[model samples]
Target: MRVRVATTILGITAALLAVPACSTDTAPPARTEKPAEAARQAAPLSSATLETRLLDESDLGEGYLRKPERPSQHNDVTVIGCPSLSELGGDAATGGTLSFPRNAKADFTYGGSSSEVSEELYSDNAAKLSHGIDRIFDATTSCPTYQVLAGGTPIDMASQELPAPRGLGDEQWSQLLTFSTGDRSTVVKQTAIRDGSLLLIVSGSPALVDRHLDKALAKATTTS
Candidate 1:
């Protein structure tokens, strides 16, 4: 179900091209304490190196295929606002349509007819990345149910906050969203983790996403 949810969401990537990247608003300040000295010492992943380490179809298990037509990189941060359950990384970055400063980003998707996985990398400081997570937690908590129009159709959606997974990053958040229209339904499991200056988001089947996240963080840790 989460894979199907991610697939539906990835289908709307083209729609994001129309959203203007003009928002100058930054995320609201977080109430948490500053990062520890050790956290600050961790290295950031460069765009080039991140691309090399990103998960491809091979890493997504057998029979999972990638789209050759998809762009290798996406620079416009504002396009994260599109309404799709699998767009968890985008939703986290923009704080549910609230834009924030992001210096660089890269995303890739692998899918089959019934399942999909989406991974997104965002480059920013620990504070900014943490703030973005806070915003998403706040939004999901305050308003569990909401609607966003995608391609002029109202999509009914609901979110449920889950306990944060440990040992993934400096800070992490997880949630589940169910999207419905008439009888069709899709459920997505999303996880956002802040590893030093990089923010990694993976959405789809929880098990697959979790597995890939561990691999990603491990590669990120070794990035020079």
Candidate 2:
């Protein structure tokens, strides 16, 4: 049984977003290339371009069906327990100094059942993108357990760190989140991969995320 979150942030953040980079830097190469690579990465992508790169029903194959896009809108959510998450009260989907200039999103459900997978793309400068990813992961981890007030009703939420998938991106973060209302609880996994100026987040059923993460990254980076 799925415990759907009542709040916008919980719904979007849960179905919508997830985040880090480890400090295992190897020594820099003896030879360095021109700064062209830096400029290229800093370049922003347009929303249309982003949409083309997102996974479609075709890319996902046989039984997967794309879910309709949610309209562009925001209903603020209030966070009561975690100071780090307090910032989320204003805009949970996307906002603030490190704002992504362009974004594209797509959602899918597998086999006609409740199993789902969603992907989001954010484009900007590498530095800003990296910071944005960090912000999400940091806030979630700031409090292992927290409370949110949505629609005048208080909901209990929990965030637990999971080993992120490696060797797929420059840096990544993974977490298992639980949203509870009374005895019913909804569990979801979010894995975020940050490569250069692009940040890709794949979240939903744990199995679905793992099954298509590599595919999502490959398609997102390739030109149409």
Candidate 3:
């Protein structure tokens, strides 16, 4: 079974912390229920936002897709304005583990997992993840996926055969795609989940979707 993958955009750095205590070869499908209240309680700083910047390898840290600018405070919710996946080399999968600078105090770190899958399977799985998101989110791109949540309401999701790159190979790397929801007035995000790791790229600027190089990499530690 596939799980619908839900990621946090820059606006608020929040993800449901459902501990994967078991190392099951098969991950159960994602639950449709909203994220826990604990995540919602994090509360976002309305004024806090991410500045648009390049998503080049130079921009990446240890292995993370960093926000253009750091949030005002540690764990502060920062919105990634707009992004261009191509700038980050579009799914080539860089080698090495990625980590945020200690000074940045960013709450999450993603990328560089010991697990992997072939490009053929990765591409096929991306399609399933895409279809699952379409069932949950209002708008999204065909390849790389992105979604926006309204009023801090977290959307539950799942995916199957999510791929994790093992250092820039033929594996069709998944990326975050920007999109909007609701009245289309507020909230936008980008998402990329394969294998077990997921990346949520976000931005909020009312109908200003672009390919301009903006990205956020939120890493969740997964077991199994």
Best by TM-score: 2
Please give the range of 10 consecutive residues that has the lowest summed lDDT in model 3. 114-123
TM-scores across all candidates?
Answer: 0.65, 0.77, 0.20
RMSD (CA, Å), each prediction: 10.1, 7.9, 18.6
Best by lDDT: 2
Clashing pairs in 2: none
lDDT tens digits, residues 1-224, model 2? 12222244224344432211111222321212223343446467788888888999888899998988776554445566677665544443234433465989888878775577888898888767766666767777667888765555565877776776756656677777766767656667777877767878887777777788999999888755
For 1-224, candidate 1 gives per-residue lDDT tens digits of 12122212222233232222121222332323334531573445566666666667666567666645454333232222233333455444334332334423333333444545566666666676676666656555444676544444545666666666665667777766665555655666667777777777777655556567787667655545
Native-to-model Cα distance after best TM-score fit, residue 33 in candidate 1, in Å:
11
- What lDDT does the true structure give each of the candidates? 0.52, 0.66, 0.24
Model 1: lDDT of residue 149: 45
CA displacement after TM-score superposition, residue 200 of candidate 1 (Å): 0.6
Clashes of each: 0, 0, 21
Which portions of model 2 show Cα errors greater than 4 Å?
A: 1-42, 87-99
